[model samples]
Target: MQPSHNDQQVDLANTAGDLVPANPSTFSDDDTLSGLEKGPSTTVSSPKIPIPEPADVAEKEPFLYSLRTHKYFITVTILLSLFTDMVTYGIIIPIMPSILEHMGGDSTKTGVLVAVYAAGIMSSSPIFGVLSDKMSSRRKPMIIGLTGLLIATIIFMFAQVYWLLIVARFFQGVSGGAVWTLGLALMTDSFGADEMGIQMGKALIGHTMGMLGGPPIGGLLHDAFGPKAPFYFCLAFAALVIVMLSLLIEVRGDEMQEIRKYAVELRARDLANGIEVKEVVHTSLWKLVTTPRMIAAVTVTTLEAFDLSSLEPTLPYYLKDRFNLTEGQIGLVFIAFTLPTIVSPLAGWVSDRYGAKILCCCAVISAGCFMLVLSIENKPLWGIVLTLVGIGLSTSSFIAPILGEISAVVRRTGDKAAYARAFAIFNIAFSFGMLIGPIIAGYIYHGLGFKWNCITTACILFAFVPIIFFWMGDRKAKMEDVAMYEREEEERKRILAEIAIIKAEKKAAGEA
Candidate 1:
């Protein structure tokens, strides 16, 4: 007859009990006591190995076995997706005014079109973020977004009138929001907090490269082959992104973090070494966003987006009218503003150490000063270039800090937190900035001229200094919380070690 499960456990315990030392002096009393205290709620016994049902394993493995699921590969796939969108977005920037001019429009009309794109992103981010989390899969939402983006690009390619072009941009922004929100969620799933900052910085490299090259490439292509050439270039990159995405196979939480059946020492060591599992708490979206630090971080994201986008409506016209610069030369000037941001990874390393308060305060102030200088009307080409270079260096310093802060707000929850919604809030703020920047900056440029536009932008940036200082930073509260967690981890390790010893003795006695 088969032994009952409880009978088997008792018989096994009796057999292994023989190996225990009678005096019990070899073990630490504190550790043994702690385990006893914790163990009354559940029996501490030898672990049983799990056997996956054959049919279940077969179903999951058959197709997934052929795909790449490594964490590094996931990063690459997401980065490629980001780069594709950014390149296409920027490739059209330098040519937008020209497209308008063909339709008997000006920079003000171009500003409205740019704002429409941002409006799409702002409206779509939260919807996609909610869908991505509820759906419990990143790849499907990402593919759907990409397909829609391609369709929008096709429309943009052949748009003969201004309103049609605006419609294309709005749809393109919606799809772009999906890619960014889900891509960030996927990255958060794959990486732990310790490395997330650097990864985010590296991710922004895609944005930086796109801004650095897109306008120049667009301007040059428009000059050489016509407006259609730039759109074709974007289409090709999007196709390659589809291939990279197809190679990815998403790794779910249980599969990615499998543990041995009864590896007590490994578990204890892992907790001690900073790989932690915390007490679960369901933080609401509003609660996360309303926190002081989070608000500051979101505000900074908006301002930086504004800082870059404000240039789009104002700078192109200013260059054409003031310096008589060609489209290619206007695009080249933007390179000065974008080139310095390539060191984002290094800046991320800094954020990990020093914190956001110093970076945000200093960056905005310096950028304002540079903008004030750039506003001077008599400056030659060299002076304007120098001012842009300064703005780039100063403004780029804050990107990684705000990004790190945004992730840091929820990172203590470890694997339990929802990342898509958090980043969706970030996207909302960023897109809002992009939406308002062009409208305000373009209005000022059209009414008061370019000088007042720069001055007004600088004044607005300077006003944010105190808010940045008051709210954005590394807080003592976080340090105290980390200390508390570490102490709890020590207690947990001791308890686990005692359990391990008991299991070892039981197995040895059973063998005897």
Candidate 2:
């Protein structure tokens, strides 16, 4: 006959217990008295050791996964990194005019400096994305990027030559691309698909803050102290990020084990579904570029960037010429334009719940009409401010929803590794828009007039609405399906768990 399971455990424990001192050297007189009181012939039995049942053991065994546990911390760290990068980029914007003057260059050369930085970002982003997705680890690329930011900050701080300054800006852009790609990809990995939009929105808050505060602080510090003051601030900020990242972020051995398990599970699932998991040699580049969802995301990014960059060069002039506004008034107008971005979190939350189709379409149309209206003659300052505010609010919906949509598509397609490259495409589109928008606006404003530039931009903005309507509408349905799939999967898992528990109980009863 077979020994019972408890008997097996008892025998094993007795064998191991022999290694423990039978009567420890420190055994007390109280034990001797008790033994004597129990009488000589009677042996004292070891306290009955309670062996935990299998189901209890399984229930009590904790999940040792770290990625999900530390997701919020990771998100904060990425946001801080992004904030530092943006601050580094923006710190010099207000001081660029002065810097250019000192170097015997004009505003056009300053524009060249900006363009070169953007060009660097555009060129390096795809490469960074490819490297990140190909690599098993995201931390290495992120660290390298932060190091580049540090080097760029040093260059900007001490460089007396214009060409050196240009080189510094280029490096800065390269670093920005790395952070944007890897950071967003990391966030995607950390969270579920449905939570991505709100998470992106939260990350964007850091960016908006950096943009809002950097220039003003730099300008103020420059006025109060010196040009190098802003660089010093940026340098300190970057250094802090590097240190914080090095200390706070690490994928432990346990996390790596879990990640390997996760990959294996994904591969098994793909095989079960008759989908071929790609080898390392397989390239998703073509697939990424050709996806209609990705095209829509890039298009939205480009148009948004165009609208933003087009305004940067022309808005101040429009306000000055149209209303004779002072510098302070122009600053107020800029604030009014950006103030609506504060509601971006709300937009993201809404997108996550209700889908982004109506929001994206309405935003573009509203922005276009507002732009057309802004071109009207003899508009009051308040009216212009209101119109700009409307434009800002409308445009704020594009980033999070579009990104969430792309992530959803990639996830549905089982190309989870493509997130980094997808965002790299976004960076390219944004950089391209930044490059082309001003050039086109400048040309049109020169060839035609300010009103014509507005007319043209408005028309272009309105055109994208239909594209959004047709493409972005499916997001809600897909999300619903994903939710249903998750629920069904959970139910299946629950049934399996119950069966296993029942089997364990029956096996123990049969042994009895």
Candidate 3:
């Protein structure tokens, strides 16, 4: 133990040599080793090895922070932009008769203008939607659309001839189509699944106000000044939207990133757990057209739009012919239709709690029933009031819930492009309905009468009830299939765990 210093040093060297491998053959034959032998055998230091932190150990964002961040600005911007467009679109409704009279155009020609605007919207929506996806930027599309809307408004403001106004309206429709489709996309990118319905409901409220207020304001302004006043107002509103958008920050980044991250993590977890993820087949427009929920929702929306288009253009004419109501009176009837918008959030809440299918079916049938009542009723004021209230409440009740459901399905299908495509199809159906509805209503009103036309519209609405039932049944069956799959997954996991335990026990025995 108390040996000399040289002996102690030799023992330490022997212990260190024992730690290294005994095989000299493991050393490489290189010029570096020959230089080392001549230079007194220098030792090299090894680099430190680093361990990576687990992905799951990363910090989770607070729920409230996740919910509130970036949404306020985006939601406000979307609301303002959408409100401007809605006002521009609806302002013409109250002033339609006056403008036609001033231009020496008949009711039929006015109906044609409405149809043309809808057609423009339908045609432009898909193009804008596809462009939005390709561009991957809402800012540019929104700005461009708002700018076009402003230019269109200016053209509309200065137009003297009916043809000029029609041309301006067509441009306005193109801009409006982009605004509506892209605005929804922006919101979807900002909000997640749980909050989307509420935020969308709020946005719809703003839109409803524009729809409700714009016609009345236009009516008042037209009555006070002239037919061109609404256009000037729209121009100012469009300018305001541009200014607001410039000041606002984009909110889509965080939400989109979160969705991508979540998707990646879920896929990774499935792979690590030895689960096979199903591959979805991608296709073109035909694939989207054939999706059952999409088809059903689009059909219902289009038919509903058709019924609405038929009724809206003919309403002012019908009222004037029957009761000779003033512009203000007509505006009031329009307001009645929008009155239910005040309760739309409540409707959305109810829809969230109850199923969308029930709400949609009930609302559609109720609206049809009320339209039938309008056809039978003799008193002009009562009929207008009841019809407006019924249609408003019913339509509002259905819209939020059905849209929520469709959005869910689109997400489940794992296609971001589907939203835009779905909306494009919706607009096409809507436009087709608009083109057909007014022409049919105009012909029926001109040839047959007002009462029969209303009855026909009511019957057309009732036709959707059976269709809704069939659609809802299919949705129920899909849910059942999902439940069965989940149960099977649970059972499979249990069996796998049992097998793994048996294998681990055998390994332990072999080691022993």
Candidate 4:
């Protein structure tokens, strides 16, 4: 008869069981067996010991394997969602001033439009994060958000007034939050811990490509067609994503259930093997928000965002005023800021091997120093471009490592629910930073001068260096402790094996 798969598994399990001592001396009631008989038993048992039947082994359909095979389809859908979301975001940048002016608004009001959109995204991020976690379903949220974004884009395309455009932008921001956060969560669920970093790095490549491609395309579309052209294109892309999602199976369905089941089974096995499994309980967002490391990471991210946003809006104007550069020249200079995108995957790989804290601290500090240098120099355009490239490189090096560090720390603390909450807090902080950046830069430049404002911003960024150093030290100490524990565990296992062998010899003597 052909053996069933379960029968094969049972045979393997029984074989493993027979190889180990059934009655070791270490687990005996008494160890006084020195004078026991040492010969094999003469009497043969009438009936053999009943091995567990293969038919009794539970049989269920495999979920994880199926999901793994379908990962590409899921990843592509997510990428498309991210691409459309970024396109919508980038399209507004070049046209913000023009859009506002067409409706009889000033540059300050246009700046408010940017702030409001950021604020909306920040506000909605945590809410969607919690919902995604609770539902454990990325598909519903993604589809709903993409649909909303499509509607918002259509509204913006035909918007004739500033208020109408602001409303559309606000909804777009809300949808944007869903697209980014859910896409990340979905990717994390799809990949294992080690692969997650690489997958996320690859995913960010798409975003970087979008950043590189979207604005230029939007600008060209705006110049050739009209301000409405970008939104129309966005609307079509959003529709394509919606249709793509409909065809793909939901990634977080039975696959996640299987993963959870496997985790439980592993936990049970560890218990059987006398290993302690740490129990992790879901905690409130407020409790997670109070963690010092989480707070520090969030704060640093926020400050970085504020510094970036402040520069983004004014950089073009600054170059125009200081260097008398045309729009195309300014665009070329902006491209330098994005040059780090190409190297970010490599930076992520290195950070995974070395550690994120060191990379983060160096990136922030070096970027600050370079910003100071850029502020002092009256160099040629290429020199300025190089300085901006340095900034981009520093920023990219910091990003993946910082994010990986935050996720690692949160997981170590056994607070899975806190992941999205922490991410939300990070976004909110980033938004606040964005708000502060443009406002501060505007005030500083107007009240004092360009050089002094740049100097102050650079100084502020440098201040994070010492704070990050201390945090890095703490993280290193924790890592050392983990390594020590693992070594001790290995030693304990060796001791247990020796004890088992001694017990088995005693049992053999007693049986003989």
Q: List the residue pairs that clash in candidate 4.
A: 25-503, 37-512, 306-433
Best candidate (score: TM-score): 1
Candidate 3 displacement at residue 502 in angstroms? 39
What tens-digit string does per-residue lDDT give for candidate 3 at 1-512?
22211111000101111121111221122212122112222223222223333333334644443333346656777878778987887778767877777788656776787777777788898887777654445666778889999998888877889899889888888888888777776675555444455666777776666756677778877778777778888888888888766654443343233334344444444456665544432324565556665566666676666666676667778787788887767777788777787666666565555545676788788878877777774766876787778887776665555555555445433334456555566667766777777778877877777777788988888887776666542334334223322332232233223333433554567832
Q: Which stretches in model 1 have alpha-carbon errors above 4 Å? A: 1-67, 253-281, 412-415, 475-512
The TM-scores, one per candidate, come to 0.76, 0.72, 0.73, 0.72
The lDDT per prediction is 0.67, 0.62, 0.62, 0.58
For residues 281-343, write the lDDT of model 2, one tens digit per residue.
Answer: 222666665656567777788887777666654665566567875434454566655577676
lDDT of 1 by residue, 299-383 (tens): 8888877876787778888988989877778878877877787667777676666666876788889988998998899899988
Top candidate, metric lDDT: 1
lDDT of 4 by residue, 73-157 (tens): 5667776777787667665655555666657754356556666667667878889878876664677788898999888888887
Q: Rank the candidates by lDDT, best first.
A: 1, 2, 3, 4
Least accurate 10 contiguous residues by lDDT in model 1 = 7-16
lDDT of 4 at 111: 57
For TM-score, candidate 2 versus 3, the one ahead is: 3
lDDT of 2 at 68: 27
Lowest lDDT 10-mer window, candidate 3?
6-15
* Model 1 pairs whose backbones collide: none
In candidate 4, which residue ranges exceed 4 Å CA deviation? 1-80, 104-107, 209-214, 247-251, 256-280, 320-329, 377-379, 446-449, 472-512
